[model samples]
Target: MKKRFWIAIPIMAFGLGWPLLAQENPTEPQPQHAQAQAQPAVSAPDVKSPGTPQLDAADLEAWLDGYMSGALEQGDVAGAVVSVVKDGRPLFAKGYGYRDVASKLPMDAAQTLVRIGSTSKLFTWTAVMQLVEQGKLDLDADVNTYLDFTIPERDGGPVTMNDLMTHRGGFEEGLKEILITDPAKFITTEKYLKDHMRPRIFPVGKVPAYSNYGTALAGYIVERLSGEPFDDYIERHILGPLHMERSTFRQPLPEKFQDNVSLGYMSASQPPQAFEMITSAPAGSMSATADDMANFMIAHLQQGRFGDARILKAETARLMYQPSAPHEPGFTTMAHGFFSGPINGKRLIGHGGDTIWFHTDMNLIPEEGVGFFVSFNSRGKNEAVYGMRERFVEGFMDRYFPDKGNEPLPPAIQSAQADAQALAGKYRSSRRIDTAFLKLIYTLQQSTVIANEDGTISFASEPGTKYRETAPGMWRDPNSEGALHVSTVDGQLTITNSKNPVSDMQRVPLAESAGLNSFILFGSIAVILLALVAWPLSWWCRRLYGQTLGLTGRDLVAYRLSRLLMVGDMIYLLGWYMALQPLFQMQFDGFGTALDPLLFTLQAGALVPLIGVGVGLWNAWLTVRSDRHVMAKAGSVLFAAALCGVAWVAFIGGLMSFTLEY
Candidate 1:
């Protein structure tokens, strides 16, 4: 969970927006081939309600029973907990599915506790705002003022409290041990932040990268200022006052509650997993029951008052909901750690979280005075939890607050084709790592915009859902509140969407395109492999017929050296892949200190490619100058060029770096 929350690398940070890799969908959004929409796919509800349906305990339960029962079973979700509050009252709270499938123990909303991943950040943000209200912290002041350590400045400026809350810290994603199996290796919040102070990739408050480290930093600051451990302060101030007895930020949970925590599973049929240990605790470490979560949600909906308790002043609670100034027109913005999305013609403020087997979403409709929280124990097939939750949100909105959408026929605009053509390209999410090998995630996750023949744009992130140019540079999803606003920021095209306010997609320039990078990497490796394999195969064939060698003297020496260098390049790549590949493959349970020495050795291997480039150039020059066959000369030149590609890919991808932070 710390992976985005590494604090979960996904916005889905909490994929928690990762393990910022798991997602609201509880799985990375893989790029899929799609057909251009003659009509847009269902991104939201289409049923036009004649009038608002009455929402009460009985109807709400009936609605949930009708929808969730089939959804959980059809999706293969093991179990779930759902809690909803209206007018500061829990209108509905229930648990569906088994808490323990092996024992067939049914889930209980008040008894079963689930880890509420990145949604835990709301408490950290609330803690910061509490200090702000007391004049103990400055939102605009440098965060360094409150900490013992320092954060280096970049594009945005000195990191500020406001910046962390808005998730604009721009720290590069790093560290693999988001969820460690061993409790003995757990690190303190302060220690984790100090050690993993991810390099600032964006200027102060420039881009929102959904930082778990940044949020954890705020929690550390709260610990420092409040003169208490983060967990203790939370227990004394927030949880105690809200009467959320079932909630606790303690890792592994307190012994008393351990038995009550529901087991997590990748699938219902799979074995239950160990407790996910998030050392960066404050970022996404909280377990609570549906009843307790409902109470916490009610506090936010009622301006921080729960029963007789007050966690925040009414104004402070109100302040927390203020959306950041819009960077793109109609694009929802992150506000004080809340994903302030304007859905169904009303502002919904909340956050979503994922921790491998468990996925959850907590949202509050401030204007409507209602809050909804849901959690699924299993990711289910194809991360179908995303669709289930989406269906719930849209269905609820349609029943309670329907939006009178436009006519079915897409509007005809003369410039739609031009706009579509111009916008057609790949865009990388700002949440990706800029200074480490984790940036490789960008290659697979980069969102592509394909221009459809019908003058619409198909966003790869929302496959099969065509977005028409609703305005000049803005495209609206016909089915949902999702909007993609394309604008030029410092001459670079930035695509900001309403669905994910925490991160935006910047147009991937040709030099940085994943397609180009992959081509260079694979094509170069293939060139080296060809020569390496042919050298011995040619000798074997010659010996079979007892043929005499054609080349002699300097040609023989240069050719031998070229083949040797190619072997070195291959060895260099293989060693590095062995060292770093697991970090990519294992997102949920990251590797520990065992990889340090191996990584150091791999760093030393960077020299092999450097030397190969020089030797390859000489080989190319000798063969081109000599009377070698045309194919041989071409192969030599290609070999040289392959070494050059390796060097370029290594430099830009940070594979050659000595730093082992990630």
Candidate 2:
């Protein structure tokens, strides 16, 4: 039920026939050493000029500031700083709201230090690209050859550097806890390979799985080949060249800098917690100011040039922007980045970052020679970030690329009732293991089902049945279908079928607990059938034969049933123990013999009651057949006591709480 919402913005220029304007003044004077300068000296835009450019600057600043204010008011951010540049020049830069609510400290453009999160990956990529240009490292070479230790093979083939860079390595599928708590236990790229060598989720280069571990490995490889620590190498090569003095990779804040760093907030309920410096620093652990990030974006916008200093050859910069693989249609995937896509019709490139307590976005409109960077110091609604970015982008394009017309909006959903009714239906799909085990069907209703599909569907008020589309060709019946299992790949739909042989079934009639109800019904039927068969057999035998001889059948049947039930109980106990084994082992003074009491209680407690119940019933049958009133009464009392004891013990031990509904 926990869904991570990622705002995927199409970096295409809005509106058709929009004219792209270049920001760099052709008639402006230039210094003799400008071409050789490594960092550009930034200055505020000249707003007093009587020209179209001046009007554009005012519109751009107002648009950006308005969105920032709206975002803060919506409780989607504690504070934010935004910087916009045109042709490697600072057009507008400002900060809004309190960085630390408890201290009542307002964020300022010069002082605020925002965590850029995965935007740090761009610097790492730039460093690696520098190495590639120097001919010191090969992108396609086997990465294990340069590692301090050996990288184990997956199905006898080593994962290449390209695989790591593109996230094609197959070691990303396991549980993250194995690495989160004690990273050193699985730190090295070589150790990770050795541990997960033979297991592969997908074939190399077949699919792109966004992997944090794989990126970390790439960082390690960069460090090893350069004979320097990863952070040190980046600081020396990339940051130093760009003159990003305040930027650092997980460095402890100095007393002077502490006041400058933003206090990142999550939801309003709890106070903000200090962000942890991750061991996997390469993926997303760098911190910087809006000015520093704006400079970085300017470098990219100018095609690897900052003022006169060229960090990379123009050809190399072009290669970085070139499509590395197929992404969504009309969009292209760059080297670990996103490139331009068809929106209205213009070209744009950008990336968004979401780390704990922060959301950031960096975008560049190359044709217009305009770029922008926005960072929020809060874990707020992702939709707010996306909406703000879209509005800013749209306003900028209208000013700079006015020739392009506005993009057409998709048709809106008018009637909720009509929409819900059209989406209800039966859906099915096969599982990887068993094709027949996965057929799923759902009955639908408006109150019972919440439609998750994008398109319109009809809804019925009475007996409330509605149809909801999860994807094209996939629909869920609101009356019968509870939670429909659906997947979308490039707008194509795949629905899970529960009736299939290998399926993991989903509940229909959305509000009902179908699986738990089925289990209870099956258990009740089994208990009744056992008693029914035992009672009839016991009576027939006593009537035809003597009491002692006739009781053998009942005794044998009871013995088998008790053993079966006890085995089932033991299996359940073992599973529970294994799940909590990590916690027990982690606790103080608990060693190998710690689980003994738990094991014994489950075994003895479950077995004794079932055995006692069977014995008492058998004895009562014999007494009744012999016309012994006293013996029959005693047997009945014993049976009642055993049942009561079983229920009492189960309740006290917290087992009965499992059956209770929330």
Candidate 3:
């Protein structure tokens, strides 16, 4: 087990809060059971559709009322705003529930503002495109060309704007100090970029690891090229033109818009927390109302011009909406800033976002000149919010654009059982913590991709979903028609839903192969606890019997020292766990330098158990030489062995490493 200690440490980490980290398959456009013959592939906004009845306004309103009212009550979500735009006009824009529950102020879709989170990246990307249209920026050029400080080339390749836009820049995901509670600590974009440059874990343009840092770096480049502050550049070139008067990217928002800001809650029952200050503001910080967002969406849907304001030229806008990376057949691809996928046979480009306590989604059906936006004020950790978003979109699509049916694909692969077996295993997301005890979460919660004896792969994390090999190394969900492309890259088993592999779940070594560490850990804890209780009882029993048969001197001292070591080990584990408990409850931005002292103490204290290993071994040798029973000698060896296993597990788990930087 000691020799196998190095197997589990993966150099990866993920965001603490949502900032577009999870990559879900795009919604299927055609129903799986539809019998219509397959039609030729269609580009976005131009998919041919059998004409259907237009959505009735009154019926839509009634349906929304029923769904929103029920969802708000059942999910315990505080409030929400819904906006729908079609044919360059606002079809619906309204708020449901309260904006400020204590004051009983109702939400106002045109006035009340909520944090838009990662969806704010659209504005940053839009600004970049505007500059590119003017030849002030280059999408394919090395980003270092515009930066004051050079970004070191990885594998002889410089990261380009295209790589950043497509989320294939290879930077490891970041979390620490990314979100700060205090506005004062929210440093400038340049400083934030410099202080938190992540290590590149994948080669450029190879993987799709969602990165807030990469987005922020793009924003910084925009600032440098435009010779203006990022917020100012966006306001002048994007927001101001679109007449989004109620939207802002500033933290602690401008005084006039502050009162309209909706409070964020963990749940409807929980008290509201203060507005968070995103350290990477360009990635996930923007506050806007439903109407303001509607206006912005209209601009994108209409080829960059909204009313009299124009953000990007037609060609640039078209380029921005196009896929930046390759994708699986029948799957969505990464656009410049948006995620483009099919819905009800209609091509849609959209973005979804989440702050600690707010969740939102925005999608545009360009051909229909329609866009939908929904945002909830509560985080709703039970994921009721996510369910609501998916259901709402699906229902809306089904009603307005019911599948005309499509030609079914060819027969499923029925002879790939061997291939399926080869791919079966427990796999962890590449986006995970490497240097912190948080890494244990991935180890324990990795997805189990099982190869069924039947020629299908069972995705255990999402039960009821299975895949069949549609190609040599490609699998497709027969029901949804979504695809999963797999291959071995650099000896790692990589699985991707789209063109770029987002996660590589290396085959985990069997527990037995890894020195049987899991069993050793369990046995060690059990043995040490028993010894802690039994040692004291043994001493008292001897005193009661007035026996002097036990050994003294070095043996007694070593025995006493071993017991003290167990006390230290217990204190370290328990103390560390207790300290981390309150942290999980605190706001995402609330963790920072304040947590260093306790973490350092716990790390330093874990070494005490290593001392126990030495003391236990000494005691074991003396106990065997003494006039002790055979059972007593066996117990000594077991206790000493347990001490070694305990120390090894702790060390490998990073419980003993001292680093406050996370």
For lDDT, the strongest prediction is 1
Considering TM-score, where higher is better, how would the candidates rank from best to worst?
A: 1, 3, 2
**Which residue ranges in model 1 land beyond 4 Å of their true spot?**
1-12, 15-52, 327-329, 407-416, 443-445, 461-463
Candidate 3 lDDT over residue span 192-300, tens digit each: 7887677677788876667778889999998888899888888898878777878888876788877778998877777888787777788878999887898887778
In model 3, what lDDT does residue 191 have?
A: 80
Q: Sorted on lDDT, highest at the top, how do the candidates line up?
A: 1, 3, 2
lDDT of each: 0.75, 0.49, 0.71
Q: Look at candidate 3 and tell me the lDDT of residue 320.
A: 93
Error of 2 at 481 (Å): 32
1-662: candidate 2 lDDT, tens digit per residue: 00111222111000000001112223422112233234543433433323334435677666666756665767555777777777567666677777777776776655577777656667777777777888877877777777665654655366776666555565422212212222223243334433433234444554444454565667777887788888789778776666665678744444556667888776433477554344456755678777677667777777788765667777777777665643433333445444343333445566556555556767777665667777777655543544554455555555554433333323343553454443354221111111110000111111223443544343222234334444343444433312233344333233332111112222233222233333333353344344446656976888778665333565556434543443444354354455345333322112112344554454355554455455545544544455445744564444434343333333333333221100
Q: Enumerate clash totals for all models, in the order shown.
A: 36, 59, 8
Model 2, CA-based lDDT: 0.49
Query: Tens digits of per-residue lDDT for model 1 on 141-215?
Result: 999999998887676568888888877877876655656767887777777887777888777666767778888
